[model samples]
Target: MKSNVYMFLLGTMCLLLLSCGEEKLPKPRAMLRLNYPAPVYEDLDMDCSYTVKKNKMVQIKNAKYTRPCWYNMYYPDLKATVYLSHYEIKNNLDSLLRDAQNLTMEHHIKADGIKNKEHINEEEKVYGTLYIVSGNAASPYQFYVTDSIKHFVSGSVYFDARPNYDSILPAANYLQNDLMHFMETIQWKN
Candidate 1:
């Protein structure tokens, strides 16, 4: 009886020791990681009236409606497109500015907020505002750069996916930086 009890106790202790080899821990939650390549830009080679640098990742194509100097800069990987429309400012600067602002305002209903940054390059005669729209708006970015006399160009970015602010935030931000660089490198044809 004593020997059997000792054996049983030793077995129990062995079992416990074997089972306690390592403490099981719940793993931390997984997070989504997105990585994009650094941008390489080159002068946009087109018959358009104005000149601007564009990321090499984008493909420049005529817009669907195909107006004069209207283009769509498409990022195949990101499934996003930047729509650009150029206009010769023929006494319509006020209306052109109004239209651009109105287009941005249309997103206000769905946008959490809209923040705009003014851009002015006195020597280049480039002046405009970059509108960053937050929320699930269809267009998260919009801008218009104009010499306020002879040239006006406006652009907006739209994704192919359904408007989910969180899912598209990273791509939107990447495009935003590209757009800023594009704007800075713009030079109107005199």
Candidate 2:
């Protein structure tokens, strides 16, 4: 029995020596590597007052409401959607702009910071602002494009999962570029 106990201790000592050879390391924190396909954009085929280019990977569907011209541009693989709403400007441009701005401001409570980038294409008559919200906000990006006379269109992006800025950063970034492309390609039918 003493010899068996000694053998067991010897085996444990061998394992401990072998395991201690390499100084242990808490693995350096690693972030997820997310890869998305290169975006191929084409004019979004829709019967609306204006047309814009959209990423081919996006699936456009009507919003879940009765409002006309409201759409949800869904990215199935990313599990994210860009909600879009169109309104006709009829002496309510100020209110429309305010509403769009207010929507973005709503996320301020949870956002680390908000950056507004103005978009202006005088030739296309598209003038707007893109609001990029950082941190764990429900919506990471929002924008409103308007001719400032006849039409106003606003959009916001939301992911299906809970907001975790670090986890969703890559996908949010890809969608940001896509949204910018959408804004750049707007052409009013009227």
Candidate 3:
């Protein structure tokens, strides 16, 4: 029958095309390769209560002038900013800790989990809690470092891009190293 002849011809053509590797198949999904250089750091001295050594890749921006010792570390290349908020304990140490804890917990709705780590340098009377929030949230990292007496500093790292962990993970991780360096070098003059 003509139908049988047509079916045979179609099958032969399909086999020939496949054998020649002319039929392109969709490729499996793959991630992009984003390579960044290791950071070089320089000491950033401010006239504020505390001093820090920050990453050379980051720049200081006086974004928060309403409060004392408040500024932002702007990473123009990454389109991200690490907002620094400092507080003098006054008579409200408990209140400041509570507020910092609450602010970090606010991201729980979008965060997969929040891991808190405590750091203390007794010789310098520096103590603090580092919050690494895992998820696609407005802030990927939040931390508070205090001397438990006079100085309290908190920071949040936020990207200008949408809340996509995959896209911002590299930048977040890069800024995190800078943040830890900043915290470690913090010298409270109070």
Candidate 4:
């Protein structure tokens, strides 16, 4: 009986010693690494009175006519949507500009920070501001491009799930890149 007790205690001590091989510590915070394929874009032309390049990954859906040129760029794989609305500038530049800025600011309550980047493509006559909302906001990105006279195109990206940046950041980033591409390739049509 003494030998058996001694053997059991010795075995337990050995495990305790070996277990110290790797110092066990709480895991540090980590983020997921998402990699997407090289994106392909196609010319999105229609009766909407404007043209923009859209990611081939996104499926264009004709949203219920808010006006005439409203469209939704849907990412089925990412479960995200980029809401797009185009307006013909008819002396409502101030109103339209104010509305676009207001829409982005609406996410301020839940956003940690908001960054606005000016987008200018003098050749394409597309000028706009890109808003990147950082945090648990519903809309992580928003922008509006215009000729500053006859065309105003705006967009905002939203995910269908709860506003958890960790889970949604990858998807938001993908969509945001697509939005920037769209703005960069925008052209107003008559």
Candidate 5:
């Protein structure tokens, strides 16, 4: 009888511990969205090209710059640069991305009751800090910006925290909608 009582108490404690642990979920680091105008590449007649897709929400452009990697994405709420970088320009891009991340962190804290946290994920081709924001009234969002030896790129998406899957979806969808509109209006100058 004593053993049985002890086992029951232990099981209850384990369950309580599991329930009390902080729930971890994927979140966005920023709330900005991208939009681009339709592409008219053939007219350019250069090695570089641009295209519009996803109902004009994604503007894709390619150029051959010093680093052999040049592309740009402009969303209604956000603008992204993925292009060749001269050795000197690399540091500037890095600084810009870092500044943007810091700005996002400050904004997240001020976003109602949202809590902001950062997750750093790096890869050879792409790397940047992701800001994840969460709150009862707010949807979790991720801000990801990355680049490569010759290119720089960044983006964000509002996503719900795992398991809950309740609040973030709307925000994510909203961001997507805005991005599409943004891409449609983008124009690249000669």
Candidate 6:
């Protein structure tokens, strides 16, 4: 009789422990809202113009605008498109490239706690570099600087979901190449 009672108590305790374990699982949180620059496309008819910042690294010559689409699976319910901000001259293009390098490095360091993957590609243009970051939950962000137009352009695609803490390389390359294309299309207004 005692042996049977002991076995019963042990089984009951095991059942209770299993129930408690299930209750301890974490619940999923709500998606975070992403924040980025509000795109300014005042000149939709003619190519949009961008003003040179104090650095004079690049100026907006003209940009072709396209409405962002929902087809992009990585970034659901968010809008995104290529912006072609052009610049003139190559005098400070080298400095712009250097700045891009520093900016990318800082971004990587900051994201080290999360998803952080990056690659740098040069020789695609006469004097330019493209940086790409990709990952599972995050969309890629790109930066491209060029000596041909003295321009450094940056762009990124982000999603409503928390980016996967891995695989940040694809988005990085996408944005960088797009910026380089924009620089290539720039025409000097002066």
- Model 2 lDDT tens row, 1-190: 9999999999999999888876776998887799999999988857789988999999988899869889999999899999999999999999999999998999999999999989999998999999999999999999999999999999999999999999999999999999899899999999
Candidate 6 per-residue lDDT over residues 54-160, each given as its tens digit: 11122233233442211121222233333333344458766655665665555554354333233333443334344444334243454443335433444444544
lDDT of 1 by residue, 1-190 (tens): 9999999999999999899877899999886777899999888957876788888899887899868899999999799999999999899999999999999999999999999988999999999899999999999999999999999999999999999999998898899899889779898888
- Identify the candidate with maximal TM-score: 2
When 4 and 6 are scored with TM-score, the better candidate is 4
Which residue pairs does candidate 2 place in steric collision?
Answer: none
Between 1 and 5, whose TM-score is larger?
1
Q: Give per-model TM-scores.
A: 0.85, 0.87, 0.85, 0.85, 0.32, 0.36
Tens digits of lDDT, candidate 3, 1-190 = 9999999999999998879966788999998766677888787788788877888878789865777678898988888998998888899999999999999999999999999878788988888888988888789888999998888999888898898988888877877777787777888876
Give the Cα lDDT of each candidate: 0.92, 0.94, 0.85, 0.87, 0.41, 0.41
Segments in model 3 whose C-alpha atoms lie over 4 Å from true places? 1-25
Model 6: residue 115 alpha-carbon error in angstroms: 13
Q: What is the descending lDDT order? A: 2, 1, 4, 3, 6, 5
- What lDDT would candidate 3 get against the real structure? 0.85
Alpha carbon lDDT of residue 74, candidate 2? 98
- Model 1, poorest ten-residue lDDT window? 45-54
Off by over 4 Å in 2: 1-22
Error of model 3, residue 151, in angstroms? 0.4
**Candidate 6 Cα deviation (angstroms), residue 146:** 2.9
Per-residue error at 117 for model 6, in Å? 12
